[model samples]
Target: MAWHDRAPDSFTATLWDGIGDVWAEIRAHPFLTGLKDGTLDHRAFVFYVIQDAHYLREYARALAVCGARANDVAGIRMFCEHAAGAIAVERELHESFFADFGLSEADVAATPMAPTNVAYTSYLLSAAYGGSYAEAVGAVLPCYWIYAEVGRELLAAGSPDSRYQRWIDTYGGEEFAEVVSQVLDAADAVGPSLSEADRAAAAHRFTTTSRYEWMFWEMGLRRETWPV
Candidate 1:
């Protein structure tokens, strides 16, 4: 079986398969290929890092909401703590990049969210705040799952650029994989309880976000901007 098909659980397996096309496109995206080989443009990487910092803030909020809606103590603890980790842990990396590039808070503030980033984050926030825990989980899962998968793959390929290597190491490392597993386990735990409608809704959420994950890479690769 392909690596993408080797999901952690049956529920996650379905979610994984549901968007196979998106996954293929992600795998084929120039941004990812360039990243693996250290050929990606510095401008694209910079654009991605800034947009990601913004994304993580909104993601933390969605996660906190997931924690609030969690039915179990474990789920609550995981979501809430992971929420903190998103900001604290990931922000450290972003901050270092900011320093390297001589960017200040004011600089980040002045940078507009690319249209795709805006749409994607808005979709995530809506799913998180307007839906059930399962729904929120579905929406957020692709970010965890795809990054870990890509990170590991890219790490194995190895980049010549230490800058890209650092990112590859961060996501591809065991720590991030463990984080992905926890979320997959959560999906499995809740899978059986979801009603048919809820399950379908969650599935839709997964597919949609998975596509956004691809578009995100495309946005960075192309250096997307507002036409108006």
Candidate 2:
């Protein structure tokens, strides 16, 4: 089968398909359940948004690097468009978040970075800069896909007027969907170009990034030290 044809099901594509199942269970203490319900306090919400905004900056930077690495004008154009789109939508989303949190952009920009935040951003940057464009997409797609899926779910689970709804709406909207579609299409196209090892690597990178994404959210919800 083609590499793309061999990609995992939804369950398996999310990080080795349950390596962290035990940890996830343990981490799901009742307090952590608060996060599931989106009942985060103002401070936690602000912290999450601040850290998230910083991540978004790196997201664009990674996409740009990946575009250059692709060495194809069409690929580069897609990445550039994705980067511009991220800047427009994510920054505006962050601004809205800042307003919700009563924080200024400077305030969020100045906030301290957690280890998970740094590590996750670094992974994408490294992948984009040091690895091939296919690999870079592998690293970055999880963040976009996970947020879009989860955000859409969150919106469906409750009243549409909640503060959390706004957050979900921003990323779960059509603009973000377009980005996901673009990236996935890119992935499908690029998969055929990769060798077996590279294809496996891309798939692995994607799954790993997805797990980290879950942890990042869990950490933010837990309001604890950033989980690895």
Candidate 3:
């Protein structure tokens, strides 16, 4: 029922292949490569997590919109459940990071969304709110897909830093992989039913968000801020 299950030149497959350049850049980025090797600065890691916490709030909302737009009970359940799961994981995992780093909730609350974070979340929310179901799926898929890809790869390298390992293990583990596989299946299931216009729109949404996926890492590395 998922892409990997029945996939042969599937929609998500094309989406994945189309982003080869971006995907390669993501692999090569120092922030990510450092994550695999465990040399990533703890400050940058914490900064990334705080920004991710902010991003997840809106992302969870977009996911709910995906549920709302879903044509079937299965899609509805998947998005809604993951919406809750996103928040739950954030609370458990991020809080552990904060505790280990001596950060209070106030510290996380005071940290602002970097400019790119704003732009990226804004794009996701816009697509979710304004687009068709296929478009919404496209908007949200990169986050699920890219993180799983990166996390699995990083887990293989097995970061020496226990903290990074927790992050990698969460994304790379069988459970998370199952979730991603389900989403990919959902994309394939819906692809044949969409109109040409909607399919094009979905492709555009997917490609754009794929770029933002890369920008997110740059944001962490640079601690991006508003220039003004």
Candidate 4:
């Protein structure tokens, strides 16, 4: 059966489709286009990537917990596997990025979280602890899905043959595809049955999350700084 078929109902499918649509739109946004094409400044964007990498393990662990709560053995396995992959990728990517740019983990960690950064992490943790596995997936899809789309667009837009290629390659590659597919499938399994009010609440959460994603790119370009 198709991975999506494992989803219990159409509600879950709709949620995943909605999340994917949001991500695709973000990819095509001009703001992100400029950022990825190197038309924008680098410090904030670089800081975002490195600091965000530090949180991947937390994100993955939360997903695993949610999956287990839902009795989703496959979900648990997928999150665990994906987390392992993130560990290796994060190590390699961060080290390379620091070496290439003459930065360090302290630089990124000491940089206070941008509003967008905090929003992204907050939404994930909130959804993971307070929502279902499907909800958690919905909350997290923006990052992975948006990066993949942005990676493709950046490449098409003639992103240089530089270290940025690693960022593009990591997100645009087969590995990320699998991670996204699994996340979407998990979202597809959780039917969105909240009442109209509940749906409105959920939609609000998602929209806010999407908006924060844009803010993240903006922060990158602005080189927004904050206290540690």
Which residue segments of model 3 deviate by more than 4 Å? 1-6
- How does each model score on TM-score? 0.95, 0.80, 0.96, 0.76
Candidate 3 lDDT by residue in tens digits, 1-228: 532344556888877777889899988999988888889998899999999988999999999999999999999999999999889976688889989999999999998899999999999999999988899999999999889888878888898888999999998888888999889989999988878788889989998999998999999998888999
lDDT of 2 at 92: 87
Tens-digit lDDT string for candidate 4 (68-99): 65546777787766667666766678778787
lDDT of 2 by residue, 58-131 (tens): 88999888777765788789888778877786788778878876888778767777888888888889888877
The C-alpha lDDT values of all candidates are: 0.89, 0.68, 0.89, 0.61
1 or 2, greater by lDDT? 1
TM-score of 1: 0.95
**What's the true lDDT of residue 40 in model 3?**
93
The candidate with the higher lDDT, 2 or 4, is: 2
Ranking by lDDT: 1, 3, 2, 4
Indicate the residue-level lDDT of 94 in model 3. 88
RMSD of each: 2.1, 4.7, 1.5, 4.1
Which segments of model 4 are wrong by more than 4 Å?
1-13, 16-25, 28-31, 55-58, 192-204, 226-228
**Deviation from native of the Cα of residue 211 in model 1, angstroms:** 0.4
Query: Which structure is stronger by TM-score: 1 or 4?
Result: 1
Q: Write the per-residue lDDT of candidate 1 for residues 1-228, one digit (tens) a residue.
A: 333445555788988878888888998899999988889999999999999998899889888888898889999999999999999999999998888888998898789899999999899999989988899999999999999889988988999988888999999998888888888888888998989899899999999999999999999998899999
| Sliding window of 10 residues with minimal summed lDDT for model 3 | 1-10
Error of 3 at 221 (Å): 0.5
